[model samples]
Target: MVRDLTALTTDMSLQEAVRIFSMTRVTGLPVVNDKQQVIGFLSEADVIGAIMPRSRDMSGIFLSDFGEIARKMGQARELSVGDYMTERPVTVTEDINLSTVSETMLMERLKTLPVVRDEKLVGVINRTDVCSKLMEDREAI
Candidate 1:
């Protein structure tokens, strides 16, 4: 588990979130509430979808004109993370086994998962975490 995690608040502006993403090189971030409970998730794709034109399936077809896309991108600067975050995203408890986490990630197609304990965000698990754990186990074996 990665104890040093970056999280965002629902009221944070999309522009700020984008800056965080760029600085951290993270694809997604957990959105927490006042009590530090995970409430939603923000992804780079979500931000791009808000700015760029795309179908429901997220196919990158160039249907909109440059002016229209530019206008939407500009409008997106004022939007908050809550406006585009995935509410009630898949999460896991800190005590969950690695196998279970791997299975959940595989089944749900998640890249990252927020770790919670007693309904509060504690850490995060990502594909890198899974791989690192597996490598460690292999080394032990």
Candidate 2:
């Protein structure tokens, strides 16, 4: 797990979140409250989905011109992380076993999981972290 992790606040704007994502090169980040408690998660997918036009038909078809796309993106930029973040995100405790962590990631189809202690933000575990630890354990055996 990465002990040095970047966290977002609920009130942060989507534009700021995008900037953070670009700077950190992370696909997702955990959102925390003022008490540093994990509350939600924001991902690139969430941001993109927020700006994209939702399909109105059962066939899942939609059309938008560049102007419409730009307008939606402008609106998204004014929104806060809370508006699009996944609330009550799946998280792991520090004591969780590696297998359980891996299973959770797979089951949720998540690339990252925030590690919490006493409901507070602590660190994060990514797919690479799990795979590397597994490989090291195998080599040690």
Candidate 3:
């Protein structure tokens, strides 16, 4: 489990979110409320989907016109993180077993999950963390 986690609030601009994503080099962030409760989840793909024109693949350069791309990018700056966040995101509890968490993450195709305690944001867990734990267990055995 990663105790040192960075989170974004609803009111933050999409530009700020992008900056955080770049600096942290993470694909997503948990969106928290005033009380530090996880309210939503924001991923890089989500931001890209919001900023770019509709495409079957996010990285696909379907927009042949540069002006449309520029317009979309400018529009993204005006929007807030709340506009692109996925509300009521899937989450996991601190006490959940590693296998269960791994299974859930795989089934949902989630890269990261907010670790909650009493419905409050505490830490975060990702595939890397779970994989590390598995290795540790194997080595110990």
Model 3 residue runs over 4 Å out of place are 55-60, 63-65
In candidate 1, what are the lDDT values of residues 1-141, reduced to their tens digit? 889558999889899999998998889999999999999999998898787765534554565556677887787768899999999999899889999999999998888999998878998899999999999999999
Residues 1-141, candidate 2: write the lDDT tens digits.
899658999889889999999999899999999889999999999998877666555755345445666887877668899999999999999999999999999999999999999999899999999999999999999
Q: What is the lDDT of residue 41 in candidate 3?
A: 95
Query: Which residue pairs of candidate 2 clash?
Result: none
lDDT, residue 95, model 3: 87
* Model 1 alpha-carbon drift over 4 Å, by segment: 56-60
Ranking by lDDT: 2, 3, 1
What tens-digit string does per-residue lDDT give for candidate 3 at 36-127? Answer: 99999999989987876665465667647556778878877788999899999999888899999989998999999999987789999988
lDDT of each: 0.88, 0.90, 0.88
Best by lDDT: 2
Better of 1 and 2 by lDDT: 2
